[model samples]
Target: MSALTGAAAVAGCGGDDAGGTSSNSPGATSGGAERDCSLKHPVCTAVTSDCVAVHDNQGATTLGLRMAQLTITKPDVLASGYVAGLVTQGLTMNLPQCNLNGTGTFSWLLEFDTTTGKLRTGGAMPTVDPREGYCFANMTAGEFEIAPTEIDAPLTDGAWSGEAETLNVPIFLETSPEPIILPLHQVRLTDAKVSADNNCIGRYNVEGLEWDNACLPGQDGDPPAFINGGKLAAFITLEEVDRVIVDAVKQSLCVVLSGDIVKYGTGADTNTCKRDENDQIVLKGDWCSATNSPATDDCADAYALGGEYAASAVKINGLCPQ
Candidate 1:
């Protein structure tokens, strides 16, 4: 197994110029772009094998990573006539709404679970049961919802441009009287994380300007990342939430960190073995790459899940499932 390594950053959240670009912006989503890469959308079917696993030989450990793009809707926060009157008679109390059309990718691993077929993230943990990470059961099991974590992909090509606007009346415009409008320029992921069987992740970028609300600094704002291809739209729906749970509970693919599962395990520890009844086999010698010491780290703590998988492994079949 080769040691995992890479450089990733979430471009600082600064002024428009300082902030890094997002996926699905104008001129970002072009033909043949990695961001737009995906399999054709099949008809909406019941919980089945929407997942396709590409296998590879490794040591005793079997790691699998699945990627999927999904559509999600954001619940809109509408202020009634009363709230609108407080701001300005005719103006509406507007807030950002998730743009379901935006496409994003989610990823998960497959390992063993004592109760179900496997154990994943996003479940009650021994220490914190209700709090968990992304997990998936067998191929048919749905994905589980864990706290949302940010995937850092550098701002290369295939990026999207967007903005978020909000109304701030920090002080009643005693003199100016007009509620100051705060506009936050931003970039969003065009693809949303739809399900566990279809979680997606990677160096995401975009090609089209999903132009949303345009504003002049204050008063109200554009639909930020939640718009065309932003945050809220990036959430997993209840339909396949359990799959996420299953995937989260499963182990991440070794190929995600070593180009091949065999190398991943060998690099980590040639003697490591996969224990069927015990979940310790895969994560037994888990260590912190930054610290280089065995520590109790969760799947999210692994370097591969942190966008280091690109160099460590070859992206095949849109994901790597060992």
Candidate 2:
């Protein structure tokens, strides 16, 4: 969640000239006493989802700021096609309707803190206070702010189309009136199965893909590491069709989706683990203490979570492939 710095503190639990922590502030917890993880709120155990949900929905709002949404689409995307991951690098912001001005870019880099992919803005815009109906009330003609999120990735690409919307606007009291809403929406390349030729090509490299504990727990040496004690599985396919073979290509590995490792082994001596694609090793999925012993089981479900892999590497096993 973004923070309101300097002097943009008013409606909700915003602070003043003195920088105050949200928890320490008077009204920070005023929103219905901060709902707990009850049957009403329900806990989401998925790791990958936690960050996206927070930043995607309430991020700008938490900081008392708003975000712009970007969408991309392709004109002639075939019915049987898919892009595992697409990155958006450059972006610009403009709000002609609001009679306001500012700048910034949004991208996929924020999805994973460690990724190098990113989008940047050229300048700043005044913060959008939904409380004030996204009003640009505080700033003079020149002052501005920047708001961004990790969910703005281009979901589709292939003769594509795109749009950007700024959530930075104003809001008014119920008695005051209505405000402008910047709804970001897009439909990128749709999902479609590969053709027979493509499917045949996708099948040639099945042996190259395998699950291992590279991204699992106890491997990074740092407990706080993102993949520490985590589980992962990948399915990789290499195919040759139409005289074109997508080599060194990677798609998705299912186990990594849940953001948690699928368990394997007996009641107590069970060994939980995940396969890390980048490092090509099995990582411990179960968390261990300095004193506790490691899991007794040597193998985790290799095909767990429908995990798939599509990568290009020189080594096919402990030794490189000829």
Candidate 3:
């Protein structure tokens, strides 16, 4: 947290022309309402979520984000069959749990908060129904949990950054016997900003999303105390990939099509498939062997994951059933 001075109010939040304190200053609250994140989210019990509390004197704004997509670009985690492709698609699927369609209540939320002095972010569950609108599930958190539960970063000039060792990413795959948990490591989030436009954009990391200056929200160039868009980079070692996912990958990759882990040839030969003496198209290390996969393009050890994501804004209309 650096010193804030000289018209340092966030973009959307109004600041005093005098550069002191105003009704719209960063220290201002929502109409002097109690700053209790628990009030916004009733479903997020202490046992599951990290509740956020608004101090009596602090000014803060909270944004409830639903996971729009988590697309994995690196490693080419494609499948050998249609079933496998469907499984891989789950990582980027637009599930209806967001309550925007038929109204199946679900929750996978993150709280992006810009307080008077710090930038805080945390995740919690929200049981929202389409009829009920946004649940704003209790986003209260104490001391931003480590090991990747919740994190706090320095908001420098409206840009903040932080790193975590690993995080448990719960991704529901359609072709799995059970839910799939993606354990990510060496996680790094960079280029976080909240302005009319900046080099960084979007709330997620993945491929195929095109967000630029023209696509950003806001008008004035002034940045806020909290950041919005940035790049999320992480790594997943071969060992880190779950056996079930490996099995899923095996179903779609040629390397394991024959029920054996057939790696590519020695040397710089990184081919997706090669014909053997019998002319059978055999799968090699080409699946996760992308240049950015891991081990510096040597896919024998890991896979590189990258992406850009977009988030839908929702107003906290009501609380969820306790």
Candidate 4:
């Protein structure tokens, strides 16, 4: 988010007998108003010149939070496939408002070649490994708005409630049990709050979230079985978040996720994934057994789901350090 100064109120002046004119020009006032609008105002165009900047800041922050949650609750997937080499390119964001009842949306096409650099594989489950691939998300039509009732005034000083439509993104998993297109949908982030200043959001909190990946059929046409629903809470100072974004632009972004993640629903079966006393993820199940088998392999069944598998901890190319 960028800081914008509000337009200075111009007093309308009455012409004098000598036909004196106001010092402020109409064009100048209009331009200034346009500049001050954006998120600075309660409403503005979704697509603006600073759209990329805003998205890079806010979007990346959102993604980082998501990654942090994934690392804490799904370390198996984060370690083996969703590594740090991934980056999103060609992004376009359209935020219609910076307050409640306003739309916050964006869409982007991905370029994995730049991020992965090369294909690589080797992990507990050799079936799926980190590899180069592509992904795209078109969430421009989704609704994003603030909750007026939750706002503590001074507008930019206190916690603010916000909500965004569920995200549906398509990803190409090149090295899974079989290369396939996985459409992750029904991904909702709820009870979100942002602590902010006039310039940016210093920290954010998400109370509940859910993402389902049952779009594709399983082996032999079985029902797709990856479902993740949980709650995530984390903190990242805006300054630190900005640095990460800068590094990411240079293709050097390394994110170390350290946070609290709670899993629920069908995914909480064994409850073996948990955080250590130091807040690092700790994996506890056998990772080598086949799914639903009587075998004692801890993570095998979990790992098979790729992005859906939960883990206690994850370190990705030094990005997500233990």
The candidate that wins on lDDT is 3
Residue-level lDDT tens digits of model 2 in 82-133: 2111101111112211111112122111111112222221112222321112
Residue-level lDDT of model 4, residues 136-234, one tens digit each, is 221221121111011111122223222212222222122222211111212222232222211122111111111121111122112211122222221
- Model 1, 12-44: lDDT tens digits are 211112232333322223462542322222211
Q: Global lDDT for candidate 4?
A: 0.20
Off by over 4 Å in 1: 1-143, 146-255, 263-273, 276-279, 282-322
RMSD of each: 24.3, 24.5, 16.4, 22.7
Name the weakest run of 10 consecutive residues (lDDT summed) in model 1: 305-314
- Name the top TM-score candidate: 3
Give the better candidate number (1 or 3) by TM-score: 3
lDDT of each: 0.21, 0.18, 0.33, 0.20
> Global lDDT for candidate 2?
0.18
| C-alpha RMSD of candidate 2 | 24.5
TM-score of 1: 0.18
Order of quality (lDDT): 3, 1, 4, 2
